[model samples]
Target: MPHRSISAPRHRAPALPSTDYDVIIIGAGSAGLSAALSLGRCLRRVLVCDGGPPRNAPSPGVQSFFTRDGIKPAELLRVGLDQLKPYDTVEVRAAQVQRVTPGFQVFEVEAEGESGRTFTVTARKLLLATGVEDELPPVPGMRDLWGRGVLHCPYCHGWEVRGQALAVYGQGKIVTGMALLVSRWAPDLVVCTDGAGHLSPNARRRLRQQKIQLNEEPISHLEGTANGQLRHIVFKNGDKLARHALFVHPHQHQRSTLAEQLGCRLTSKGAIWINKHSQTSISGLYAAGDITPGPQKALLAAAEGTEAAIAIHETLTREECPK
Candidate 1:
């Protein structure tokens, strides 16, 4: 019964201030921080509350992002904070939000962090930049190899494993698509359906034409070295397949429980539903990033962040002037 020590810490929110902020953004990841930068430029009082566990923290580096492609997550975030520093209106706090409640003019937020301290702040508007969690498969040893030899985004790590032996793990029709796409990087690709039904005739044809192995055996477990680098895949039949890397299609879930707790309408995939203005069904509350229940990608999350900030800014102006 011990918690994982992810980082050394001194987390404490300053005493609850009396003034109401123009905006309060929760979950300081790419989306939350991006929105804060935009609102700060407008001289809005923006408070960013960070719980500090990012979904991509396991990945070695971020890719496909313009200008900063392949940069470490910490480095990217550090540079982001430096850029946002000039905007004096923004304050970054390393605190965990406990709850959010609608108030008369805005909303009330309670946050607590290390040192057993708590602070409350009120905001005229709220933005939920909470992201999503990758629901990994229940396979043993796979979790340890995640973001190292096992990955999700081919666009992110395909180059790194190009020409290596790769395995695509999924079921049904999805595996067909993953196999075809992943074959671009590695000619030695295996489609592991985990004892699932066979692919369609056309699907099987496409895979063979691409020279990808269609493997229907159930996965007994993943084999890795003592250091946790994946070396091979062990099947239920006691056969071992050498695999340099793996591609998994994990189910995703939203990270923000507060949004659901506050009654924000969610998508079928459990993402927050927002309009063009990024306003959710709950007025004064907006959401961005993977938490919104759609396909998850970094560029898309950042775009949603910027859009939410703009929408919040407009609402602030209208509410402040009452015109």
Candidate 2:
């Protein structure tokens, strides 16, 4: 048999007359980058627009991602960009998408680059890999400690602070559930209602049954190290609790309004609704990552992005190259 070098076949989008692309992915986080990798490999011209400041940018390291665990978030993104260097069909830009308008057979995307220059491009498909923004609690020092000693997603940061004195801070019914989740990492867990006192008697009983302490006193402020490592939480009544880490359920909103402006439906949780293939309610528009309703994680978002790209490629093939 003739020896054949097993090289990855390079695929490029057919040269179109206009400056348009097969797909334009907004927010070049894990999901957007992963989607671009798949689409580029399939010969689709992909453009990923990353505005700035990723959701996990404040975090020192990304956790729970297999093989790349503990790598800094920015480094992970840099690695992803490096991996895409071989795919000539894929390009990344640091720009903010201002608007997306549907066209005859494409979508018009207007974006502003860091150099204060504006540009527009047309794309056959749009992928909203734009992740959500974490709205931290208003408590003093809380925002500064986000993604550090103050964190969310126990599965993501739990092991890092395992066995440390952990505190869950929030109000209303959600905090009760959060307390239970945080207990897995630190048995010595405390739930602070921040003076809301929304927990029912039954909820209090449940916490006590699990040996979790419940504090209704309003939090005065959070005391942490200069580097964002939480040390103590002071109460309004002059009481202080020593805690190494605080788990919070911070409110989150979509980072970009482009999806909403495009008329895609959102979930009750304020996430972009997508089908199993990651297609949004609008045809030719897709979404993935934290913007979708699910337990948000880096690996999960990457997988969802891959799925959305495959679906987009298949749809385009069926429409453009029918048998």
Candidate 3:
């Protein structure tokens, strides 16, 4: 991604004191970093705190992103951080935000550093770019194959597993929908419901039409290659099925509770609810990335971050010069 050079303030405001930052962005993934870049160009002081490893840590490469396709997740973040070096106003840290206290026009944030040292900081606006956490099933070897043979988001990894003997894992209507979606990538797909598929007659008919095999047998475990790419689905009855990859739409939850703690409205699916400007239900509180309701992708998160940055700058401008 090309870095935007900071030329002049968008609304012509004097620099804030070093003691206070304009925005505190949590999570240093694509969303947070992209926001910092945009806000920095707008002459906004940004402090980005990375709670921990990104949600996509297990993924080997990022697909579907423009220009930076197939880049390692860590390397993409490294390049993003490196590009922010020219923006002096933007500061990135490895601190984990412990708590956030709402105040009149500012928010007090407590965080702990790598050395276990804790400090408090204040920012006028708070952006929670913190993403969500994938809750995979309890099946053995599932975690090990995650991001490799066990995958999510067909757009992100479908092409890599395309034409491979693939299976979709889940149950009920969700799995049926997933199998149909994965079929676009996998011409011949298997739907493994683990047990009692709970599929409707229509769903079964659709699967038959698409030639998707439904396996309701409970999976005992998964066997994979030496490199951890899944190879087989072992059943409780000693039966085994060969499969190169397993696609799963596992359950997910917010990685951070800052949004919930601050009483921000959440969607039915537990994502932060934001308006057109990315501002959450709480004034001065915003969210982007997978934390908010939308498709979870690096490119989409970065785009949302850029949009949030522009809106945040505008909000600040209005506050400073309210007609």
For lDDT, the strongest prediction is 3
Q: Taking the tens digit of each residue's C-alpha lDDT, what string does model 2 give over 1-323?
A: 99998988666555433547989999899999999999989989989998886899999899989999999999999999999999999989999999898866588999999898999998988899989998887899998888898998898899999998999988767898998888989978999888876888888888899899989898899999999999999999999999999999888999898887888899998999999888999988999999999999999999999999999999888766544
Candidate 3 residue lDDT tens string, 73-181 = 9999999999899999999999999999877778889999888999899998999998999999999999998999899889899889888889999988899888998
In the range 1-323, model 1's lDDT, one tens digit per residue, is: 89877876654543433556888999888888899999998899999988886888888888888888889888877887788899988998988889998966569999996656998889878999878888888888899988887889888889989999999998878778878889999978998888974688999899889999888898999988765567988999999999999999888877768988998898786778998899999888998987875657676788789999998898777655552
lDDT-based ranking, best first? 3, 2, 1
TM-score of each: 0.90, 0.93, 0.94
Candidate with the larger TM-score of 2 and 3: 3
Residue ranges of candidate 2 with Cα displaced over 4 Å: 1-19
Q: Top model by TM-score, which number?
A: 3
Candidates 1 and 3, the one with greater lDDT: 3
The stretch of ten residues in a row with the least summed lDDT in candidate 2 is: 10-19
Order of candidate numbers by TM-score, starting with the best: 3, 2, 1
Q: Where is the poorest 10-residue window by lDDT in model 1?
A: 10-19
Model 3 weakest 10-residue run by lDDT: 10-19
Task: Name the runs in model 3 displaced over 4 angstroms.
Answer: 1-19
